[model samples]
Target: MTAKAHADAILNLLRTAPGTPLTVLDGSVPNGTVAPYVLVYFADEDPELPDSRPLDGQSQRYVVRAYVHSVAGNGAMARAVGDRVRSALLDAVPTVAGRVCWPIRREEGRPPERDESTGTVVMDRVDVYRLESVPA
Candidate 1:
């Protein structure tokens, strides 16, 4: 599947998952978006290795970010949201249109950090995942 399809699948999965925070279909959070929200977006595609073949399946990377506003400046709430996202996505298979996708694998993770650019006390955790797929 294409990268956009992979991202859409991830977004849909998170949006429908029980106990998951409100998920943003696009990566950008609206100006007044509430905290404890999730952002899902397509990051990058894996480059084929030297030994890879033309018929080899495609691998795409997607990023999920969990954000929470906390007055205490602690990232506990953000971490909790991140945990929910991981529980719902790690090693989970997402349905991609016109493709058969393998179980998703986490490529990297960033612990919760404070973001000050928005002029509010916000914490965010980032998780990156890779999805492999072949045309159905």
Candidate 2:
């Protein structure tokens, strides 16, 4: 997916949940010859609260994951593409910092891949979330 599309997906998830914590389980590039391009958009709501008071309605952080696919199953160029993707996600998070709440974690987006054959794992970029927010 394009960078704009990826950002849009994240925004959609955040808007949908309003106030919640969400996690992106995984992301990848599909292997195929079709417009099999799929955007894996997701959102999770954090139900945890600082206290268990009746007045505590709680706030949540919404999350999303986007995936892009190249025809190659896995290759150097693909790795580069994936790396750029992860970097983009990481860079995007800081844009939302300090706007919602103080002392928050940076939203995280990481590229983690591995090949058991060679015992090699590649994590291109990682961004952790701060304050249950979207990069405004």
Cα shift from native, residue 78, model 1 (Å): 0.6
List per-prediction Cα lDDT, in the order shown: 0.64, 0.35
lDDT of 1 by residue, 1-136 (tens): 3767777777776777776345554657677776777766565545565554355455432333222221124488777777777777778888877777778777778877788887878887777766777556
Could you give the C-alpha RMSD of every candidate to the true structure, in order shown? Answer: 4.4, 10.6
lDDT of 1 at 82: 71
Residue 65 of model 1 has an lDDT of 29
Per-residue alpha-carbon lDDT of candidate 2 for residues 1-136, written as tens digits (9 for 90 to 100): 2233334544443334322222222344344322212234333444444552234454433333333321112445445443433333433433333233223233444443433442433322333432234223
Where model 2 places Cα greater than 4 Å from the true spot, the runs are 1-39, 49-55, 63-73, 94-131, 134-136
- TM-scores for all candidates? 0.76, 0.37
